[model samples]
Target: MEGIIARRVIPSDNSCLFNAVGYVMDHDKTKAPELRQVIAATVASDPAKYSQAFLGKINEEYCAWILDSEKWGGAIELAILADYYEREIAAYDIQTTRCDLYGQDRKYAERVMLIYDGLHYDALVMSPFEGAPEEFDQTIFAVQKDRTIGAVESLALNFARDQQRKRSFTDTANFTLRCGVCQIGVVGQKEAVEHAQATGHVNFQEYR
Candidate 1:
């Protein structure tokens, strides 16, 4: 399959992109800050290259924010890290169910794997102990462009059905809830229930 054959799970704490790179490079999450530092410097070094238009409301502060261990990273950060490391990076988009390639033009033989589920990022790497694929070793995969494209499309169709099932769960992230007794508002069902149990307030209402 032109998809992730093996994987590592990055912490869901928004720094998954950088952590993924760290795993691929050193198999250490602590190295993630090194990746973040390089990326922040890359963006700060040339504002024109990563213009407001290209970054879309992302400014210098945003670059600094990316260095924060808890902040999320996106494609722009991913590309910068790939270019800095001079490695081709493959991000498997679970929502699209296909892998997207970055940094092919860079001069390095190394490759890294990242997994994105629209809202979050994770890491995927070929299993080191497993037998290598026939065409390539566990570190890399044969670049079958046509097959990858077709596979991505097919996966997208199937991914849509999966999203349908998750639609309600996804919607709840932003749906606010107000406690009737306390009048203190909160978000998500879990928190609401927790607040009710702790405060002994049973009444609740949803907001949007």
Candidate 2:
């Protein structure tokens, strides 16, 4: 019988991407520090390929930035981790309901799924039943298994759509946030960015 694809929500401690990747790769969620080091080392080893032009920051700065646990990881981090692990990372977006496949061209032998809700990342797993334990979860799928891939993709899309309908995503553009450092309120991503830039306060909590 086929299994059910579900989202394994990672923590919101700003290391969701790394934690999600860790969970799918090793069933271990506390590997963010190690993964961050891996990405930093990889970038340091390939200065030309991961140059400031590509990374939007100097190679050394990018490496240091990634090492900070508060820094969020995105496509660059996903691509680097995909190459490092030699597996395809398929990220499904809740807002767009689109699956962005990293390392898809490399034809990696294994693939893992992740759910992205604008600001956060979560792992996707297949379970024997609707509420099975994490020990019974299957996070990796064979890349060449067309039938299984199709089923997984369909389920991922459905899950994304369901999340979208429920407004389970953060509207970063217009969300209200309070700076964790100064208890100052900001409206939307623009104001938040401005506040962070001016005060160097990176911690923020969303409020209704």
Candidate 3:
């Protein structure tokens, strides 16, 4: 089993995904906007292939919104990047220890770590650095022992089960809230509605 050598914390200011990918590819976090442009352009170039069902309700304006540095990115954007860069993207949902892989069918799959915790994105690079930092913060989850794909296979299944539990418990309002402004999960509708009332964030989508 391989060990993690270094972890880079991308700012959680909505551009975390682009920033993380930029850091992983070029070691330059400042290039986030450039990466964003690449993604937006990739999608904009072929809206027929990328929009509608794939983009959900985001629509054509999503391409424009994604160009903004304050916009958040997700699986859709990750898949676009995987196709554009022709590399495998391994996104780990740390909250449930679930791993989502993209671009597996590519002839070459250059692995890049995307550490996610429902809302933010960070990156972890494997061993062999010239002068790597010895210390890592809580944002990092360095491997402590040998791990195989089998060891983590249950995580996604467990996450699904947990979601099922939540769905079963809440019969009155069987839905989850995704913030329109920041694209973060806001738990139940009560909290989401309350948050909107308190913060004037009226835009939200209910996901089952």
Candidate 4:
């Protein structure tokens, strides 16, 4: 019998992406620091590849930024880690119910699934039964198993749809935020980034 696909929630620290990837790849959640170091080293070693034009920051600045434990990881981090690990990382978005496959063109030997709820990431696992303990979770799938991949992809979409109905994602484009440092009101992610850049205030809380 086929198993049920479910989200394995990772802690909401700034390193949720790293933690999610770590959990799926090694069943270990404490690899964030090591993974951050790996990304920094990779970018630093290949400045020609990870250029400022590509990273939106100078290569050395990006490496230093990524090394910070409080800095969040996104597409750039995902691509680097996927290439380093030599496995495809399929991220299913709850807001859009779309799967974004990293390293898809690499013909990797294996793949892992992660659930993204706008700002946070969680690992996707196959459980032997509904409500099963995470200890019974299966996080890796063979890239060659077409049947398994199809089933998991369908299940991941269904899961994302359910989460969508619950409004489990932040609408970064329209969400409101309040700066914790200056108590300034900010609208959406763009304004929040601008506020941070202008005032060097990175603390923000969502406000309904």
By lDDT, the best candidate is 2
TM-score, structure 1 vs. true: 0.61
In model 2, how large is the Cα lDDT of residue 176? 95
Note the Cα lDDT for every prediction shown. Answer: 0.64, 0.92, 0.63, 0.89
Clashing pairs in 2: none
Worst 10 residues of 4 by lDDT: 144-153
TM-score, one value per model = 0.61, 0.95, 0.63, 0.94
Instruction: Name the candidate, 3 or 4, with the larger TM-score value.
Output: 4
Candidate 4, 89-204: lDDT as tens digits: 99989889888889888888888999998889999989999899888889988876452365677787898899999999999999999999989998889999999999999889
> How well is each residue in 1-208 modelled by candidate 2, as lDDT tens digits?
3788888989999999999999999999999999999999999999999989999999999999999999999999999999999999999888788889999878888899999998899999998999899999999888764523756778878988999999888888888999999999999889998999999999999998
Off by more than 4 A, model 2: 145-148
- For residues 1-208, write the lDDT of model 3, one tens digit per residue: 2343344677767788987877665666777788888887887788778767878745568887788776678888888777776666777665455678777666442555666655567775554343455232112222212332332234333543454445322322435878888777777657776887788786776566
**TM-score quality measure for candidate 4:** 0.94
Compared with the true structure, the alpha-carbon lDDT of candidate 4 equals 0.89
Question: Clashes in each model (backbone N, CA, C under 3 Å)?
Answer: 0, 0, 0, 0
